[model samples]
Target: MKKTLMILLATILVMLTGCGTENKSGGLEISKDVAFGEKDYEKIVSPANELGFKLLKEVEADENNNIFISPTSLFMALAMVYNGAEGETKEEIAQVLHSEGIDPEELNKANASMMSVLNKEADDIQLNIANSIWLNDKFTFQKDFAGSNKDYFNAEIAEIDIADSKSPEQINNWVKEATNDKIEKIVDSPLDANLVAVLINAIYFKGSWTNEFDKNETEDRPFQLLDGSFKDVPLMAMKEKFSYLENEKFQAITLPYGDGEMSMKVFLPKENSSLEEFKTLLTHENWTAWQKEFEVEKGTILLPKFQLEFEASLKGALKSLGMKSAFDENANFTKMINEDDQVSITNVKQKTFIDVGEKGTEAAAVTGIEMGITSAPINEPFRMEVNRPFFFTITDEETDTILFMGSISNPVQAK
Candidate 1:
């Protein structure tokens, strides 16, 4: 694990981190067909938690999240499309996504996308032609923002000239009226929209702990930081066995979200107990090893109650992750938006918010494929031992997108 220190405001803090792909030779499969299967969604969700952990470290100096996605929505949208898509279109869509650096073999190995991937992390989500038309057009919704083409004020909608009697104001107003506020502008100016289309994904999760953490035992415990310091932070502790695993690199614990459908897993390194050392060991193989060892058993746990937030521009990140062609204006999105002609994704933007307090966790996220696309404090007694560095993430068992990614070493500073 490599380490970097970023100085924000007046405080300097150390940061450590981690990506994803296939399951060959230890790599997790990332293909749409096989992506949902093989627990690829779990694979993706795991790293996201690592990202959250990293952000928690950085935010110890500031109060801004740095990653984004709506896990539940992303999963639901993927589920809808998975069940909705059939025959050639389904296979074609799968291939396109797989070609963008995912494993095609896994996709081919599975039959129904819903059967295998629903409740699993999905790499790509799709909607049927009917659903897209109904939600994006026929349905009435508020528009986000609008203005004349000449004045150029609306950030999302620009260049629509109001010269034809309507003026920018009316033109903008129409957009505001059409989207029902789900979309703010027609054209994200500077960026042009050749044609109009909509892409929506939804995810829902209900997971319960194999063993619930006892609120009665929650208490503030000292959280160790990378700088060799400790702060008294509340940790939610419960004495019950869970699916626990330990390897030469780190100690691991798996806590199911609500139903058995979703879960949150944490990984902490041993010996050096540093983020860098643990990150170097966070690989598909290591993940596979941990998964193989996971067993439904009894155990004790002490987790921190903290909230986290993150927002990021994912265009560059997606491009770097291998979907370069999709970013091209000439790329193929016919299957995605259900158009005869290909539509390109001009911009992608995303935002996420999470809160994990004493009364369970509440999270909300929005990803605009501009595209586009928590915390806690404890005062009560009962020990919530979230000391040392740990990982956290939000995931949908359906689509394989890691909606939000982060970590926390010092929960007190994790704004």
Candidate 2:
């Protein structure tokens, strides 16, 4: 079996605004035709949560920096790639994804089912997911690999001249359109002539708060940073009933969005506990325990009106999470193409944007795994104030899948 050089790009945009509806622009659309058994649903959700925390830990190594990530976007792109992997390369990817025991075919079915569920339209919210494959016209890809993606992921197939100057634009345009123009470009530079194919996934989510925050209540307030310095930022205030929890270490609250189909959960560490310390306790076990701890309560909530944009190379993070062979020369991706060409990943990059204000939250993220590759809210009433750094996650309540998550150390800084 020969290694396949692969480059994957994934983007996610979550927009929180006032009640309104917008039509999505152009992209390849997939029909809801895939199905999965009950076991498949279990296979999908468990590993997704595990990967969520694992990736979170890797990215949060920088204690003082603000961090945001879309594990779903990254997983979907790689899951498509996993369909084309065999042997040790496949094993490594599986371990990293925490899908070690599950059969790859079964995993694909689970993902397809999950995607269908997530793409279901609701009147109050818009969650759109689009996928595509751009292949170099010169190379002949395996039919089975291509067909699986189309059938399972609803990925559109296109043949492009990789050497042409317009190639990157074609791929980035798909990204821009899928992300509602929030992310204009995923490829900042031209592709290498030797590059064969680029697999891309984009998810866009826009929804209004179940109870929109009153813009009139927003006021400039002092936000304490991790370093003891403070910056004056617009703090959006509200007094509403919410699912709330408080323990010795932190206080948490869940704010619903779009008829309670989705929510933002916020975790504010106690003044005595450092954010870093709280993060150590954020495992899957702890998260489930915390969820079980929530209760209905009424209290005042004060959150900052902040916006952030972040970009980073994720090669180190994925490698640290046991996806090492895919990046090394010894890697093998024989299932990608029938030819004997050896392929290894070259780079992986991610970019994300987020804005939180009186209306809601808007966030976007793009992950480019070149085989190059590889790849919240919260609330609180009970007088909870997000005056200091905290952790938050925006999730699909029905499926319990986390869409976007981050930690805010300073609202004014946008790195």
Candidate 3:
């Protein structure tokens, strides 16, 4: 009886934890606990960060608001959606996502492994990533598509009655909870009639500066804007030994958070050059080079304390990244559902919030990919798919993007 009870208890524990499960779907058996260490993390940095840099330029191409984005959140959400993508749609997404040369199974495991490693949170800082898929209760989606994301991304799958007036709130509430109320809502009050599924990824982070600034030392300082104008802002002050870099175009520094496990890199464009000009120089090669240029030096840093909440539709940006097919009404998402039902991404939007203050920094982001009913073209498999000095980013590696996938925030563009 005792032995039987122990076995029963163990089974119950597995059920509750949602871990150590065998993930087999679409002819691939994925390992739940895939290995992703510093070296593995480094190998994928170029591809992972390449998209974020390009997307940032595209997002800011329209207007210069205090820009902030979570490449990880956006990538994870799209990666889930990619499972159902096929044909040209899949290839475009793969190119834009920098997933070339990586097979489907490997992509799933890499995302899963990276997220798992990041979630091994420490006591001093908090970083959380949540993914989910909400299917229209009336819609029929591919079981394998749903299962792949569930197994690899650890997504919470649900069926929502779109007719229900409270359904939008239900989805928003998850965003609220996932972001610790930092983000209150993601979906609109009246859900779209064409909407079939919404794939979402939310990230919340709060961390204290390793070399914290003195609250009392904060003073009003003149800060430069991208337009060459100056505004008086409350600037936080800290003097200490830190990694500092100097280039002809910009000067940069690193601000570690939570025992140096992660950090925010800050860059300031040289007086002769403007933030606008420096932004144009943000190539993948430059990012890699900039990461290595930082040498430890004793310096006093003055940083402005600001907050920004920005939201925008990423349809344009995604399309700009050569992912136009997925957004088309005739997009081939056959792997996600029957071709007759037809589904494609009608909208890809993101909402991000950040507050940098004396005690610490708090930020949240939510990316929602809205799918609508369509007649998809049939084919093979599933599909899916930066800073300013005057920039700040928190990533696992300057090259590899670890901090919940790479995060870029440049509130310094304060108008």
After superposition of all CA atoms, the RMSD between model 3 and the true structure is 18.1
The per-candidate count of clashes, in order, stands at 86, 17, 11
Question: Which digits, one per residue and each the tens of the lDDT, describe model 1 over residues 1-415?
Answer: 2111110000001000001121111111223322234443453344333433333332222242123344333322222232223344344333323322233223223322332354233222111110111122312212311111001111122222322334333433433333222223333332222123233222222223445567788898998876678899889987665788876777788865434444667777786566666756655456656688977677777889876666655456545434455445335433333323333344444455555544344444444543110012355668767768888888876997688878977667544
List, residue by residue over 93-176, the lDDT tens digit for candidate 2: 898788896676787888877766676366667777777888888877788788878877778889988778898999888876
lDDT of each: 0.39, 0.75, 0.66
TM-score (C-alpha) between model 2 and the true structure: 0.83
Write down the lDDT that model 3 would get.
Answer: 0.66
Q: Specify the highest-lDDT model's number.
A: 2
lDDT of 3 by residue, 85-190 (tens): 8888888878888886566666776776666556534555655556667777766667777777777766677888877889889988876666555556767878
On lDDT, the stronger of 1 and 3 is 3
Tell me the spans in candidate 3 whose CA falls farther than 4 Å from its real position. Answer: 1-43, 61-65, 375-415
